[model samples]
Structure formats: structure tokens, C-alpha cells
Target chain A: MSTSPTARRGNAVGDAWVIARRSLKHIRRQPEMLTDATIQPIMFVLLFAYVFGGAISVPQGGSYKEFLLGGIFAQTIVFGCFGIAIGLATDRSTGAIDRFRTLPIARSAVLTGRALAAVLIGLLPIILMSAAGLVVGWRTHTGVLDVLGGYALMVLFQFAMTWVGILMGSLLSTPQAVQGVAFTVLFPITFLASTFVPVDTLPGVLRTFAEWNPTTSLSGALRAQFGNPDVVAGTSDAWPLQHPVLYTVIWALTIIAICAPLAVRAFNRATGD
Target chain B: MAIEATGLVKRFGDMTAVAGVDLAVKAGSVTAVLGPNGAGKTTMVRMLTTLSQPDTGTITVAGFDVVADPTEVRRRIGYAAQDATVDELLTGRENLIMIGELHHLGRVRAKERAAVLLTQFSLDDAAERVVGKYSGGMRRRLDLAATLVATPEVLFLDEPTTGLDPRARNELWEVLDTLVDSGVTILLTTQYLEEAERLADHILVVDHGRIIASGSARELKRRIGGEQIRAVLRDRSRADDALRLISEATGGEAAFDADADAVVVATAGGAAAVAAVAGALAEAGIEVDELALRAATLDEVFLELTGHSADAAIEEPV
Candidate 1:
């Protein structure tokens, strides 16, 4: 890596940490903001896993609670990306970022910091959702290290989605626009993916999109690593459970590669006092 | 020169906000950009402070290019924009401390600077409170304090006294005077004629994206054609007689404005002309209410150069 700073190279990680730390302080100051992030996912997990657990069953799977957690974890992460979009839009409308533009700090630090903060906030929902999933009968067959590894990958998936959220936030004119656009994009992106069912059971068109979808890849990878029995990306000549980790990694990188630069350029165009 | 610009231009698509212009501001002096609404005063200041880019121009502040070396330029200058760009959630001390950190100051130094500025701006009493809870004057003062955290070589103040009360305006003027006395170069923009007159060492009169005149306040006022003799009327009927005598005495145009209830006499110098006019009025047995003479004000120069009536029936949209 080049030591010299490029226009694109900011202390993104450091700035992200500062913003994320500030967010933690904000959460502490106003605990009500924590309610949505820390409790919403758990409520959804409990509501779905118990209310609909009996009806959602696969032919070869046992204890639908075990399979539900992976799917919901994926859904929670994708849903949590909206926080980043809302935060960025708020900052833009208020000209907070505009003030940063006149400072000597690298230009990319503003969005990068906001995006990282979003993902850190995202962790609360993921953890609460996982615990709620376990209460409904989740039993991971993996060791402690594998559990950590699996959770880390999920975090990375959310982090990648954060960059996309920041891009949307920067492009949108207002916070209300962010909410509308997030709903429009996330509804289709989550529903078409294999969040609730196995890919083999869906119709051909839906199943094809589900199999290729990045969210499906992320959920599939986490489930396979946890020793869940519903994996079907393998053929007769291959292992019983196929690995989607590589595909998940690729998708995360690809989204960030497209999003990070676009966000910087869009941010540079905003006007302020 | 602390700042230099040659052919600075900023175009917003089809509309040119700042036409090509040249300017030089000496270090340790206060220069003001004076203009009415939409005269591009804010745009010119933004370009000079490196907050916005000029479409085509060469500009430098503190010997750094505003276009190519904006970061270096930003390091040497502190800019407080027309709108207060303050984070309301943060405390006053936090706002200033955060800015100090962004400037790469050590923690001890950042805290020290924040402490000093808070006291200097009389914001130390409210330093720990959130900005969202601050009053307008407090917020403005805290914003100014945050900008001063780095003690920059040059300062850019855009409409610093707008939205402030008379007391707050006077307080802010004193603060600016203090900063100016410490050898900091300042470039401020405002539509407040009295503000420019009070604080500016040199004033640049801008209209329609161009500088119409630039000089010391007295020089610009003196350049606005000569003296103005003004007097309030004891009765409306005496206006015609006063106008006739003043025109004959000064050998210049004399007019009485009914709305202003005052007579205007043009002459070489306003003080002597006022004396001469007063003596002539006494000899004619004309009674007067009030009379005085001084150099032309920014209001008069603005109306004359922009060709806008001071009391015309034009309603201001803002």
C-alpha cells in the first residue's frame, strides 16, 4: 500500500472509529435511539420464529428455529443499512458535511465515518436477533472459534451494505427521500433472496434470482458454516454442503468498489452556507 | 498581500454568480465586501476562502492556490459562512475541541485552545450545554469560537452580524475589533452599511457580480460626487424656497423630497455648504428644523452606483 495520501485515501478507518464512538456517546445520551436498533430485530425474530415457526418447515430440516436465525440475521443486516442512509441525509441537509469540506481533513472522511458508524450500530440488531433466534430453539453445532468466524463474516456483509447506504444517502435530496428509496430497494432485494425458504422449493424464476442473490449467498454461507442441513448449492459429485463464502466475499467487495467512489463524487457537489 | 485574486470567476450553470474580478487584501487589515442581496458577495467570499471552486480564475490565500492547493489554503484561513454550520447536538466545548482535533492539535493543546476561545467569546458559561439549547447569539458566538480554535492566519466572516440584535451586533463588533488588533487579516461581507462603516479598513462596493468601487470608507464616500446638505423642514411650504436658494447658492441641483421632508443641496463640501445654506436661509427669514453635513454614506453610494432608489416603491422579496 502506498504511504502517500491520495485524494481517495483518507483515514477512513480512523474517522469511522471516531464517528462510531460518537454514535455510542449519542446512544448513551439519548437511550431512546437505541430502542430501534437494539430491540426491533429481537421483536421481529421472536414474532416470526414463534408465530410462524410451525408453518415454515423444510422436507429434510429439523427444528425450523435453527434455520430461521441465519435467514433473519441476513434480513436484519440488510434492513439495518437504512440507518446509514438516514444519518447521511440528515447531515447533508444540515450542512454538517459542508463545514467539513472547508477543513483540512481528507474529503472522503465524512461519508466513510458515517458509513462505519452505521454498521457498528447494526451489530446491536444482529446480536439481539441471534439471541431471540436461540430462545426459539437455535442450536449451533460449531465450536466457539467457528461461531466468532461466522459472526465476523455477517458483520462484514453489513459493513459492505453500509457503503451502499452512504451512496444512497449522499445521492438523495432529503431524509424522507432516503426512507422511500430504502423501502423501494430493500423490499425487492430481501424478498427475492432465500431468506425464509430453501432455494430448491421456489419457482424457477424466483429460485434463480434467489440462488444468485448476494443476501442468499451470505445467509447460505453462515448456515453451512454452522452445520445447518438445508444447503443445496452442491451437486451429487460434490460435498453435501457447498460453500458460498467466496461468493459472499466477492459480492461485498464488488458493492463497495462501486459505492465508495460514487459517494465521494456526489458529496463534493453539495452546496452549503 | 495576504490574499490575491486575478480573474476570479464562478458560474452556476447558465448564471454567473461571480464575474471575473481582481482583488488584493493586505495582511493585518480588515477589508469588507459590501453589497445588497444577490450581489454575489457571499459567492466571492466562498471562492476566496476555498469553500467553493471558481470556474476559471487564479486565486491564492496566504500564498496557496485556492483551486489547486485548497487544503494548504484552508490550513491558513478560518471561514465562518453566512449560515451557521454548527452541530447542534454537540456541546460548545465539544464543537470547538473536535475542530481542534481535526486540525491535528495534540489533546492538551486542543483543550487549551478550546478553553481560551470559550472564555474569549464569553461562551465559557454555556460551554458544557448542547448547542441545540443555545440562543441565536450564543450559537453564533460558539460557531465563531469553533472557527477560532486554530487561531488561523486569515479569517473570512460572511454576514457575521445578520440576524443579530443591536446589543449582540455591538458585542460581535467588539470581538472582531479585538481579533483585528491582534494582527489577523480579515475579509468580511455584509449588506449592513453601518457594519462596513464601523469595522472595515477598506470597503469594496459590489453590484451585479462586479466591483463598482473600492477604497477606504471615506474615499468611497468622497468619490460619490461631493457634498450633501440636508435639513428637515419646519413646514412643507418652505421646501420650494429652500430648494431655490440652495440651487442658486451652490450653483448645483437642489431638490426637496416630500417623503423625507428634507432638502438636498449638492456642493463641493457638505459642511461649508450647510453653513452657507443656513446663513442664506436666515437672511431669507426661512425657518429650519434640523440641518447637518458629512461625507456621503454607503447608503447613498449604493443607491447611486446601483441605480436603485433608497425609498422607491420596489418591495423586497426577502
Candidate 2:
């Protein structure tokens, strides 16, 4: 039904920024909302560094605390998906998504904006963990460029994980369902990789799985970039472990390629007719 | 026409939520789609507003085809869903401004529009407060204000006052009346006959996904047997005598209301019918306890047109 002449449509990027700004405000209003990325990760760091670090030997004689930082970083970066999933689920259930769909802004702005917010949310964990790691006697011995590269990789991987979160959020019917399903899948995926322990110490099948896990590649890549333990490179014959950075990049890009379109499709199905 | 649709059909699995619906809403007129729950009123509104696609049919809103030029349709129309869809976490003013920004009003104009809407909806006092802290009525008003951020030409409301308290409902009705007076074409769906009677220039009764009847509220009531005069006799035995006397005096069909022990006559004669019935009863020495003329309610009209009460078990038509 025509009422007035059509107004100018907002550019997609600008619209996305507006939507992203709204999501980011939630974090500011409720600082406790950062518990997942901040307090929880810090707790894990303390628990691992003090309680478990002494017993678990680093693969290459490097400090376990230093080696542990890489795994924690990878795990937190990957779990950025859950934050995005929960946000999307809440939006869908609250009818906020329906409100957005009615606007004249670009439809792609909805998901892209959420992804942008997730990337920013992903930064909090990395920053907080770095401080927590320093307190626990963790340090990166690599050059400044390699250190920057490690953080950059974390952001790229976080970006890919956001799409997966969008997909899960769109497919899940409720926030409760998202929490249930996301944890069920993500918990084992993070644990099965080298996030908390040396992959060589696992059983035969589990070791093979961990060796090929994207989480492992990411952690190994971070270790290499930060000049931490080179255990995976020294002991593993696996192609991915040997070329951690390239392998992780391939995995991150692959996840983005596979999940982005499916996420968009699931999101459209959830919000559209 | 500001809004037009033909043969609109939407099916989920084997159940047809909306089947072969057609509509034409004139510009600057308030048309209420009156129906019970599960009558496809929301589905029809969704399709028209471009939130949902019809399996078959074409829709044109403000001269732009819904399917081919949905962005154009969206730019012209504003939709408020059955539930207040405002962001609870945002302040009342922030909600309107964000919607304005999405409407591409630009940040400065968006802020300007937000201020205007907040004051217009009497939400200025609560503008800085998060909507989560707002009362149900306040939230509803904020939701409506958000829709008006862009000065839409046509507005669609799906059960806008469904869950509001009486006072809040009346306040919302007043707001809608003002909008109509300012010439914003509106299409609203409601189960309340009073709401339709008060706000709608024309009403369409929908049931099982099709338009069963459409007319002014007065005409619809008249269609289902107009104003009725009912007389309760002091003695139940006099019901038969009362029925005959009432029908003869009003020259209209009469029936015994066993539940009320009253004789009811359908008449278009209004006050004259009541007078005639009262005079005849008294002249015939018929003892009457009470006599009253009542217009047909939408519930009765719904029953008459659909062969079921408006409050009947909501059937999911297959």
C-alpha cells in the first residue's frame, strides 16, 4: 500500500553499524553480561595455571603457563559463537527481529551487524586473558609483529565463529535451546582439542581427532606466533600441526564459507515468510 | 485504494491459515478486520505488511506491488504487531530513534522525530527510562510511537489493544482516532466489537481464513437481524402471549428466549419498535417485568454469519 513516496534506503554498512551499536550497548548497560568472556575465562586461567599446570608437562619443555595461554585464547575466541547465538536467539524471541525486518534498511544489515558486534565482543576475552596470563606468569617471547599476527588470527577466527553462532541461533527455536545445544557441541569440541591438555597424551582415536581439530590448529598457530612451546611441530607428523598458521587460516576461511550462506538462509527462514 | 489484495492464501503443512482472502482498503479510512482467535486476521495483516509472503495472490500497497516492490511497500507502511515489539532494553526515546535511523531518517532528523513522537504519545516523561521499566500501557504507546517515526501513509495494527487494560485500551483508541482524523489509512484486526464500532469506518468479519462479511458496524449488525426489543414477562407462562403480541406490534420476527424467559423481536424500527411492543403488551394486560431495545453485538453477528459464537473453540481449518 502506497502512503507516501518511498524514502531513501539506508546504506547497508551504515544500517549495520546502527544495529551493531545497539547490541554493544547491552554490554555497557549490564557489565555482568561479560562474565562469559571475562570472569569465566579468568577463572579457567587461574584454575589451570595454579591447580593443573604443575602436573601437566608442556610438550617441549617450555613453561606450561605460557603454552596454556594459546589454548585458552583459541577456546575463548571460538566460544564467541555462543555470545552471538544467545544475542540472536533473544532478538528472535523478543520480536525485535520482526521489528527490524519491517524497516526499509538492507536486510543483510541484521546479521552483518550482529557479526560486527560479536567481533567486538570477542576482543574483550582476548584482552582480559592477556592481563590474566601476565598475572599467571605467561609471556610471549616473539617479535611485536608475530604477537600482532596472533591477535589478528584470533579476530579472524572469531569472525568465522560468529556465522556459526548465527546459524545455530536461527535454527534453534529458543534461547534455552541455544544454550543447551551450543554447550553440548562446543564443550566437547573445545575439550577434545589441545585446549586443556597435550593431544599426544590422549587415546589413539582421540589423539587423531585432536590432531585434526580446527581448535587444535588455532591453538597451535597461536603457540607458534607467540613463541611459546613448539611441541606440536617437534613431535607431530600431522600436516595441520606442522603448518599451524596456514592450516588455521584454511580452517577459519572454510568455516566462514560453509556457515555464512547457511546462516543467512536459516536466518531468512526464521524471520521471513 | 491504499491497500488491495486478492486471493491471498497461506498454508502451513496441510492447514490453510489464510485461504482465498481478498481486500481493498480505501485511503484515509480505518478498516477493522474483525474475527476470533485463529481466524487468520494476523496472517492477513502479516502478508499485507510484507512480513510474510502469500502462497498465492497479489498485494499492492500504495500502488507498489508487495512482491515485486516490497522495499517500496515497506517504506510507505508502518506495522505494529500483536505483541508490543519494542526493545525492552532501550529507553523509550532510544527505541523510536533507532527505528527512525533504520527508516533512513538520518541521525539528526531521527532524533527530531523521536522527540516529536515521545511528546505526542505522552512518553516524554518516561523517555529516558528503559522500556522494561515502563508500564504495559507505556510500552504499548512506545511501540505505536516507533511505527509513526517515519510518518507512514498506511498503518497496520494486529490486535493492538489485545492485552491492554480498559483505561489503556481507551487511551490507545483515542490515539488511533487522532491518527485517522489526520488521514492515516489504517487496517487493524480485533476481536472486540466495541473497538471496531468505535474506530473503524468499515468492518470485515473473517473466519477460517476468508472474509465472511464486510460493512459498516451498523450495517453488519443490521445484516444479522437488526435491533431487537426484548420483554421479560412476570410469569413464564405469558412468554407465548408476549411473543405473539411483540411480533404483531413490531411486525418483525419474534422468538422466545427460554434462558431469559423473554420474548425477543428483531426490528429495524428502533424506538418505534420498543414503543409499539411496550404499548401492545400493556394494552393486552400482559404483565412485563422489563423491556429493552438492544443493537446486535458483533458476537451475535459473528454467530449469525459463521454459525458459531466468537468465543467458540478456535478451529484450525485444514
Q: DockQ for each candidate?
A: 0.33, 0.60
Residue A112 in model 2: shift from native, Å? Answer: 0.6
Candidate 2 lDDT at A273 equals 67
Tens-digit per-residue lDDT, A1-273, candidate 2: 343643466799999999999988776665556788789889989999998899989766879999899999999887779878988999999889988888887999999999999899789888999999999999998999999999999999999999999999999978899999988999888999988788888888999999999999899999899998856856779998898999999999999999999999999999886
What's the TM-score of chain A alone for every prediction? 0.85, 0.95
In the range B1-318, model 2's lDDT, one tens digit per residue, is 999999999998899999999899999999999998888999899899888999999999988888898888888888998889998888998899899889988899999999999999999999999898998888888888988888998999988898788999989988888887989899999988888889999999998999999999989988866688888888988777888888889888799988988888778888887888888988989988889998888778888998988756333331
Off by over 4 Å in 2: A1-7, A30-32, B230-245, B252-264, B268-293, B313-318
Cα error, candidate 1, residue B29 (Å): 1.8
Q: lDDT tens string, model 1, B28-91?
A: 8899998877788888988887778788888878888888998877667788877677777788
RMSD of each: 4.8, 3.1
* Model 1: residue B127 alpha-carbon error in angstroms: 2.2
Clashing residue pairs in candidate 2 are A1-B61, A1-B62, A2-B61, A2-B62
- Tell me each candidate's TM-score: 0.87, 0.92
Every model: iRMSD: 7.2, 2.0
lDDT of 1 at A83: 74
